[model samples]
Every structure is written in structure tokens, then in C-alpha cells.
Target: SLQRALWVRNVTGCKNIHLSSKLLLEDFPTDFLRAVTCQVCDHLLADPVQSPCRHLFCRTCILKYIRALGQRCPLCTFPCAPSDLVTPAKAFLGVLQSLLLRCPREDCREAVRLESFGSHCRGHQEADEEGDGGQGQTFNSYLPVNKGG
Candidate 1:
């Protein structure tokens, strides 16, 4: 069943892969597609991570999603327990990492390193939120901070 579904998905690129056809070669249902698709980017699953509810998203994408929305599964709104979110299998991770790209942040200017990509993204987001342009500041210039004694 999984192989057939995957074959169907691959043949149609998930755009028109249907579930109800007697031939089973038509487009998949929207709900099924949504169930399998990544909510963060609305694309086909990369390193698909199955939530407790069985909804899947790209591993990295969903982690980023969780970071933005807190620890909740987007599909069923179930609490995504910290321990439940596991890194995808090494094989899947390799495939997904090869296909994924880094965010086009000029300051980041770094390739998406596989093992540390998630950390890099989180750091980048935090840095962006903190409004610190360390790249713009000169290393030799020392700014005094007022620490109240």
C-alpha cells in the first residue's frame, strides 16, 4: 500500500495523484495531499516527520514551524511533546538535506551544513529578532554599556 501510494505520488508529482480512481492513477485527494504535504512550505514532504496524529511535514520545516508556533502539531493541534519530535532517520536526512537550501540571509552567507542546519536557522532567527547587526559593527570599535551598579 505504501509503495503504491508512493508510486502514485511520484508519477504525478502530487499535483494530480488521485486516490479514488479505479485505476488509482488520478490526482490524490486534497485532504490526503494536505496530510502528506508540509504545512510550513506547502510542498511535498522532504524529510517527512510524522506527528502523533500521523500528519507529516519536512523535518526541518516542521521544526521551524514549531519554533514559530510553539509545541503543537499543525494538523491535529495536538501538543507536540518535546520528546516526540525526533530527527528523521539518517538516510532520510541525507536525502532531504541534499534537496534543501539555506535561507538567503546576506549576513548568514553560509551554506546549509547538514548536521547544524537547524541550529543555524534558530540562531539566525534569534539574531534577526534581537536586531543585532554584528556584521555592520567594527571589531575595533568598543561601545560602552551602562551597567547600573
Candidate 2:
């Protein structure tokens, strides 16, 4: 009787359907468990990040996906700047690090260290321009003076 009641509730999509106290505790449908799972890609969240529009996805999972598409929010179409995108913090990373793997980018051989993981994944490199210019000289020094008009 309890099992049949749960089956009916699930099929009808009724949220407020009554269940006996014992049945409520015991015979909750497995479908409810599956329903709350992330719809983007069906996996348990590792360091979930909620977008401004209230969509949640794993930090590494969603960032990598967005980066491929030029850093746009997958669900809400919100524009995410390259600098605004970031990795999870230390506490969150601690929980998810083992479960969440690094981006599979071939050139990114790094394994996602906690502190510098974000910069690493983004492949942020400082431009090497310190040596570009020869010893500094004023612009006037490079120009020839014309005394005769």
C-alpha cells in the first residue's frame, strides 16, 4: 500500500500529497533523490558555484565549459568576464579537491594545487617585456636639432 501510494504521487507530480508518518520516513521515492541532482551534467557537485541567476554547477566543471564557449553563463546567458571567473576557495576546495579534477587541457599539466589552481587553469602568463626596450633615453635625445631655418 505504501509503495503504491508513492508510485501514484510520483506519476501525478503532486507535491503536497499526504503520506502516513511511517511511510513519509520510510518509503520516500528514489525519484526525489534523482530529481534534485544537477541537470547540467548528472554528477554530484564538487565545490558548487551558484551563478547570479541562482544556477549551481561544479566550479571546475562549469568554468571549463564556459571558457570553451568564451565565458558565458551556460543557463542564464549572463556575460562572464575572463577575470571574473575564478576557482573555489580553500575550504570549498578542500571538500571537493579529491572529487573535482583539473581541466583536461593538454598544455595544462598542473594537477590543480589549492592556492594557484585558478591562475594555472586559465593559463595566465605575464608578458615578458622588461627587456624589450634598450637602455632608456628621452625622445628629444633621439631627434636631431635643426639650428638653420
Candidate 3:
């Protein structure tokens, strides 16, 4: 009856079998977390978009790269177009937004949500640009992707 009642799979193809406890950020491995990171900027993803070739990137990063280089997926160098990109599914986004990151500031160990990480780390953006590599912390609940295309 349980099997007949429901089935779920994460975007990465991991089957969702347990219903009692939700997976926490601490449960994932470093490699799993790395897989979700944006290849271009090497930060936890912001406004993540998937290329036709199945590689992910921060939307802004991909757009900037494409505008400067050419229409291509940065990771695989597959020919890509602006129109060929799509934001992750809401379920996927929800999972991403749930990861926790500590504030990059040495003084602040406060954890931040993934969805608001950009704003939380805005103060360090300049320093990051100056080669200091800003660190920042993570979400929100929204269902825009599942409502339509």
C-alpha cells in the first residue's frame, strides 16, 4: 500500500523513501554540496538555471559569460541559447534554499538561509571582487515552477 500510494525522486534521481524526517543540510556530503555549487563563480547557487546539456549555473553568471564569450554552456562548452535555459523546478529550488551557510565575515558565525544569501553577503561583495573571496550564508518557500512552465 505504501508503494502504491506515493513515489518521489529528487532532481539528482535520489528516491525519496523516508517520510518521517526531512533531510538536513548536515546530512549531505561535501561532494554532493559541491555538485550543487555553481561552476562559474564557485558559490552556492543564486537564481540557478539549467542548460540544455544539464549543467547548472547562476543565471547571471551564465548570461554574463555568454555575452562575453559566445552562446555556450560554460561547463561542457555545448552550444546553448538564452532561450534554452530554465530555472530549476520548485521542489529542486526548495531543496537548494534549505541549505545553511555561515556568514563570511570573520566576526559573524551566524547562519544564513540560501535564498537570502546574496543580500546577506552584499557587504562583502566588494572585498570578494578585490580577490578576498567572500563567504556567505542560506531560504524561502514558493511554488512558481510547478504551477506552469
Candidate 4:
């Protein structure tokens, strides 16, 4: 349930700030997780980077934000340069990948690992196009059944 809630928040970019108890605050501090979450996307860190002010964000989210609203830290309004963002430590990425998220596709709600999500989502798209009939859309011929007298 916690994973589903988290998935909904991330995919929909909803500001609903409820975190289920199953997430275990001891294992993941609420504040720390919230800090790493990308404010623009409301998703767990992806290619995380840290501002000079130590604010964390997904690399793309921050870049887009910077491009849209000058070079300033979104949280503190401190001036920020492109070079001011430093890649976050590997441990931070590891923790991010460990968070369980559901597929963004409305039809597929399977829990997907963050690291493999992109490829996993692509597979779903490809599979849908293939359908049960494959690319040729041909059905196999059924053998005739023998009737018992």
C-alpha cells in the first residue's frame, strides 16, 4: 500500500503528502526522503544533484527549473549556476533505486524497480502493439476434433 501510494504521488505529481507507515520512518526518514524528492516531478531522485545550499533535486528537474526561472535555488532563492550542482553520492542513488514504484501506464500497475523502470515501461509499450496475434495479426489454424460415436 505504501508503494502504491508513493507510485500514485510520483506519477500524478500530486502534492498529497501522506506517507504510509509501511515505509518505516526508521528505515527512511520522512524529511530526508522529502528532501531528495524532485519538487517539480514529485518523484524520487533520478540522476540526483545537490545545490550549493545542499538542496537535492533530480538533475533534469533542476535543469528545467533553472532554464524556466533563472539560475536560483528553488527552495532558498539563492543564486545558482549550472556548475553549482554536484552529483549526489552513489549511496543516495542506491537508496532511490530501492524505492518501489508502480508502472506509470494506467493498464499496468506492476511494481517496477526504479533503476529498470525506463526499459520496463518501454517493454510494456512494445508488447501492447504486438497484441495476441503478433505483428502479422494472423491466427493459428485449429485442428478438427474427432467425435466419439
Candidate 5:
């Protein structure tokens, strides 16, 4: 029930799918990674947010950095506080959402767009629950064929 497990992990609104994993994003070129990558965690930005000084980091990462590591932006040393977080540009979100990413589970190989990954995982999760782990696969090879009819 790997699919089920993956679905459970993603119950939150956050992109817990680990889109930064190389298995999920390995197909992307290095240049593309630069645009979406969070320097603090070396992961594709999740809930990507910015500091008042405009450096980007994953929302969780920046909060952790400020709480435990330091009070300044890790990249630019600008004074940073939890309230300083801001939404990144809509144009940047567009690029991030468009990237084709793979499933985070070790078992799944479905490559999906960032925007669609949740539904993709949900389909397999539902199938696994339906006593038809094979259901998500639309080929329906198990059905009897009308041979020579």
C-alpha cells in the first residue's frame, strides 16, 4: 500500500510530496532548478516565500532558520523575522507549477506536473483502497477480450 502511504503523507495543504527529490525532479535541467530551488534546504521550493530583502526559501526552512540558526536572511544577511515572509511572484509560481515532476513514493514512477501531482497520487491511493491496485492503470488487461468475435 505504498500509494496509500503516499496519500496519507500529503493530507496537508503543503506540498509534502517532496518535489525536490531528484527522483521527482531529476529530469529538470540545472538552469531550471536554479529558478525554483531553495538554497537553505537544497530542495525545490515548497510553499515558497520570500524575505523582506527578497531572497527566497521554503516557508518552513526560513522559519526554522530564524528560530534556530539566525535572525538574518541566510543568503543576504538582511534582518529577517517570521512576519517578514511574503508570497513570491505569480510569474515564478507559474514556472514552478509547470515543471513536470515524478511521484515522491519510491514505488511510483508517474511523472506529473507540479499542479497535478496531488490528484495523481490520489488516484493510485484510491485504487489501492478499492482492492484493485491495478485499477489506476487504465489498460484493463485483466478484462476478457472478445477474440475473433
Candidate 6:
């Protein structure tokens, strides 16, 4: 639950965020996952970057991978460097944000849109701090799912 709450700060690329791959909807196409997921961590992208080889990876993942492994693309083995990683197009990032993911807290089974997940997660933290223990309160994002994109 703490991790979920902290993910809100991840939007600024200030920290590492980990959302379980299991939270992803099973109906989403595999091709979509391949494009959006970090090949190193196999989780939803967080501050994602595109390699010169055209493969996508979470900015943190690629940095750690190259530091631990080598200066090569993890997916294609193409020579890559920290400079080779670039922020992806805003339109592409929006698609990743629109992907719906189920809430990870065991007590909360609500499905929330990725774009709204920050507020949804914060609701849980706030409710807990208010002594609700995330029991009776519903942490609904109320933000419409961005389906048009």
C-alpha cells in the first residue's frame, strides 16, 4: 500500500515505482505489453525510454541493466548507452497511461485507469491516515477512463 501511494511521486520521475504485472488486464493485447513493458523488469513502464534500437524499457531498468550487464540493448544486443535512451513520444506515453490496471491492495479489488491510479492510490493512504484502515472507504478515482486515445 505504501508503494502504491509513493507511485504518485513517480509521475515526476523522482522515484522507482513497481506495479505488479499481474495487475494488468489479461484482455490487453500481448503486442501492447511488448511495446509498453520494460524488457528488463517485465512491469509497466515508469519513466520509460526508447533505445536507439527502437525497443522500449523503463528508464530506471535500462540504466541498471546497462550498469550491471553492459552498454548493449537488452532486447536486441545493439550497442547502447545512457545517452541512447530518449523519452518516448507524448502520444505513445499517453497510450501507456490509458492502460487500465487492477488495484494491488488485497483488500481493494477496484479496477482503476492508469492515468488516475495516482489519486486512487493516494485515497487509500489518506483514508488509512484518517483511521479508516482502508476498510469501509472506497478509493475510487472518479476520473473517466481515457478510452478515446
Top candidate, metric lDDT: 6
- lDDT at residue 107 of model 5 (Cα atoms): 70
User: What TM-score does model 4 achieve against the real structure?
Assistant: 0.60
CA lDDT of each candidate?
0.48, 0.40, 0.56, 0.57, 0.63, 0.68
True-vs-predicted CA distance for residue 14, candidate 2, Å: 34
Worst 10 residues of 4 by lDDT: 138-147
**Candidate 6 residue lDDT tens string, 1-149:** 56733442343232334454567766666787678766766667766789998888777767767776789997789999998888899999898888878876787878887778767877776777689464433433222222221
As for TM-score, the candidate ahead, 3 or 6, is 6
The CA root-mean-square deviation of candidate 6, after full C-alpha superposition on the true structure, stands at: 8.6
Name the runs in model 3 displaced over 4 angstroms.
1-28, 105-108, 118-149
Per-residue lDDT of 1-149 in model 4, one digit per residue for the tens? Answer: 67855653454332322222233223567787586576545555556688888888666667767776789997899888888999777787787666665554456667765566556645754675676634322111111011111
Candidate 3 TM-score, true structure as reference: 0.56
Clashing pairs in 5: none
Give the alpha carbon lDDT tens digit for every residue of 1-149 in model 3: 34422221111211211111122335567677665666565545656789999888766667767776789986799998889988777887898877775554566656666655555555455455665453322111111111111
Question: 2 or 4, which is superior by TM-score?
Answer: 4
Q: lDDT of model 6 at residue 148?
A: 23
Instruction: Give the TM-scores of the predictions, in the order they appear.
Output: 0.37, 0.32, 0.56, 0.60, 0.65, 0.71
lDDT of 2 by residue, 1-149 (tens): 67744553344322221111121112435664333223244343434565655455545545556655666676678876545545445564454333323333344444443233334432322211244443223222211111111
Candidate 1 matches the true fold with a TM-score of 0.37
Rank all candidate structures by their lDDT, best first, as comma-separated numbers: 6, 5, 4, 3, 1, 2
Evaluated at residue 80, the lDDT of candidate 2 is 65
- The C-alpha stretches of model 2 lying farther than 4 A from their native spots are 1-36, 82-149
Which residue pairs in candidate 4 collide? none
Candidate ranking under TM-score, highest first, comes to 6, 5, 4, 3, 1, 2
Poorly placed runs, candidate 6 (over 4 Å): 1-16, 106-108, 132-149
lDDT of 4 at 122: 50
Q: What is the lDDT of residue 78 in candidate 6?
A: 99
Cα deviation at 134, candidate 5, in Å, is: 12
List, in order, the clash count of every candidate structure: 6, 0, 3, 0, 0, 0
